[model samples]
Target: MPSVEAGTAGPLTALSPIRLEFAQKAFIVSGGRLLLVRKSASDPFHPGRWEVPGGRLEVEDDLDLDDHIRREVWEEVGLKIDPGPPFHLWQWFMPDRADLAGRGQVRVVATARRCRPVTVDATLENQESDDHLDGCAWVPLDEAGTYDLIPSLRPVMRAFLLAAG
Candidate 1:
């Protein structure tokens, strides 16, 4: 949530060749299973893949990282989540999406629990225009591992499963 200092005129730009934008992911678990959504085949990146429910953080959101995750989850699946500590952080270049091309997306992934029992809504896809989430499921970690997932998420999912047991 911290911003570049006031006095440093060019430090932000000079520090990195590519601009790093902030994004977040929520690890929502309920009834010993994780909630996963399938991206529509029409998606530009990682189409037809399963992933945790979350999305990019926008400056207009006016939230810290944790709040952003909570908002994104609510917007996506209509579920309220209690966010916990960040479990992982990683950066990647999303060249497939024209708007995101040439920019480094820094994602902070956090674990969270549903505030209450709720149905996963496949109809409420979030702000990312290109990502069409068409299916939803509550699957055990082992079962989830068998499906094709967002490539960067596999390791984190495995680690969460192992720690959970």
Candidate 2:
């Protein structure tokens, strides 16, 4: 995957500038843990940051936002979400460039139930670099903030608190 230079620049531009586009993905939860990726202790996106599992929209995974979220959970986290009418908890928009060139947004969604955990092939989740992930584990929700996270993701953390209520 091509790494975008960090910024709020609308859209991942390439064929030349002047494109203002954005795609959506989410931070999903199940079994009291929010699935996360550790960016190889060497990636630029978060470089060792603990992040909600998700990625960009692709033509192949044709579905609405909710289905897209469900698909991403399986693809990135190795688990399937229950019959969920998943709702958006919060959205993190990339910082704007001039400072926005490399900017993107992530939406975090909390699911109601955790699926049966199954042994998964780690190779499937390798979106960018397999080295990016040190390991996968079910981490507690409260412990989320204990790890490095993008600024936009902060508010989504509150959803954990609400879910516990």
Candidate 3:
């Protein structure tokens, strides 16, 4: 994965290559812990590893970026989100790993937000439950590294936690 320096200059102006694509994501943080989902082992791209729940932007979504993120959050984690604008845009470089499967290496340009928390109920659970994840959890940012995480998301979680502060 590409490691761009993230301090004073921020991420976009950091050492990024030209091949990045914008993928909207929700940080989904609450009480110092963030929500993450582990994709099914059978799927491609960091399958069976923990990462923030999100996906590519769809064309007919018709909503603005914030609405897109709010929708994506519900779709992935079954939780309602109150987005606090965009905190940061992070560039993640995915490498070819065992779990990466048939997906090609690419840059994941992500825009993030801090979301309001809510309880996840059975209805919400059923709506958002996906085959990609074997399980999901809310882990503290510091402790999240210990989980089996997608290689590219490690820095993203860190970057947002720091940015949120």
Q: Each candidate's TM vs. the true structure?
A: 0.71, 0.56, 0.66
Q: How far off is residue 127 in model 3, in Å?
A: 6.4
Collision count for each candidate, in order: 0, 13, 2
Q: Rank the candidates by lDDT, best first.
A: 1, 3, 2
Q: Ten consecutive residues with minimal summed lDDT in candidate 1?
A: 108-117
Write one digit per residue (lDDT tens) for candidate 2, span 65-129. Answer: 55665566566656555434433334333333343545433333233222233432333353445
How does residue 146 of candidate 2 score in lDDT? 78
lDDT of 1 by residue, 28-61 (tens): 6777778888888887678889988877767786
State the displacement of the C-alpha of residue 49, model 2, in Å, after optimal TM-score superposition.
Answer: 0.8
Candidate 2 regions exceeding 4 Å error are 1-31, 86-132
CA lDDT of 81 in candidate 2? 52
lDDT of each: 0.66, 0.50, 0.65
Better-scoring candidate (TM-score), 1 or 2: 1
The model with the greatest lDDT is 1
Cα displacement (angstroms), candidate 3, residue 110, comes to 1.7
Q: Which pairs clash (backbone N, Cα, C closer than 3 Å) in model 3?
A: 39-132, 40-132
Which residue pairs of candidate 1 clash?
none
